[model samples]
Target: MNEPWNPYDVMPAARSADPAAAGARIDALPVSERWKRRFRLIAKAGGPRLPNLGALTFGERMAVMFSVLGLLFGPLYLLCKGLWRPALAYSLIIVAVGFAALMLGLEMLARGVGYGAAVLCANRACALYYRQRVLGERPWL
Candidate 1:
């Protein structure tokens, strides 16, 4: 039996189906290629269940990285990015940690807790910001 010669049959599936090809496709995006590569690496680190980094822009990825590394300035960064809710939430977490540490008479522990909370908040904020910007989803926090 002869098969029909449908043009659709010859075309490749969406660019995202193959991981290697997906990287190349992402490189072609208008944003900085270096940032795209870094975002790809970050997404890959999250394992198979996570979506690739094509949805985020270079600026967005940088924002996430900066927020994660610069804990003290993270809230300011978020605020400048128009992420007021996240900034407020992070600030409140710092305040709560401070209060708890004061009640426990452990001032040094408060610093550690604040730093830890900042790291955690930065990660969640990255995901939340990505969802909001790329998927048009509301902030989970």
Candidate 2:
């Protein structure tokens, strides 16, 4: 039979028994320092689930607010993150929204709404990516 998921039993690298030392090791990943910081925050919270806006500290709240820029830069960000399927899906949804708004004489409002969807999609996709990679969550989810 085939092996189960996370077959290699992925675990943190070079982590000692100390919790602080284990958490601090996120810095060694190849991502930018900015991302390393975010990952550290995520690790502390037991991995990157969606942000509970009301529960966040100031720094975490700032990070959530900063991601709002995805409303404008969603396609580019999605592509860079190697999430091409979501990028394509968002483009199609936006086009449909624009067409519907034009028919309803509400084109301008539709632009805002459509772009806002991108921010939501970005957050969901990133969260799913992290869960799949780090926690070995099922592929279907």
The candidate maximizing lDDT is 2
Off by over 4 Å in 2: 1-28, 51-55, 121-141
Cα-based lDDT at residue 60, candidate 1: 51
- Which pairs clash inside model 1? none
Error of 2 at 58 (Å): 1.7
Candidate 2 lDDT, tens digit per residue, 1-141?
A: 134334234434332223255354544444466665665555554455444445568877455344544555776665555555556777687778878888899968787766677766656554444443334342222
lDDT per residue (tens digit) for residues 10-85 in model 1: 3333223344554554455344554355445544434122454455577754544545443556666566544567
Off by over 4 Å in 1: 1-72
Alpha carbon lDDT at 65, candidate 1:
51
Model 1: number of clashes?
Answer: 0
Q: Which residue window of length 10 is worst by lDDT in model 1? A: 5-14
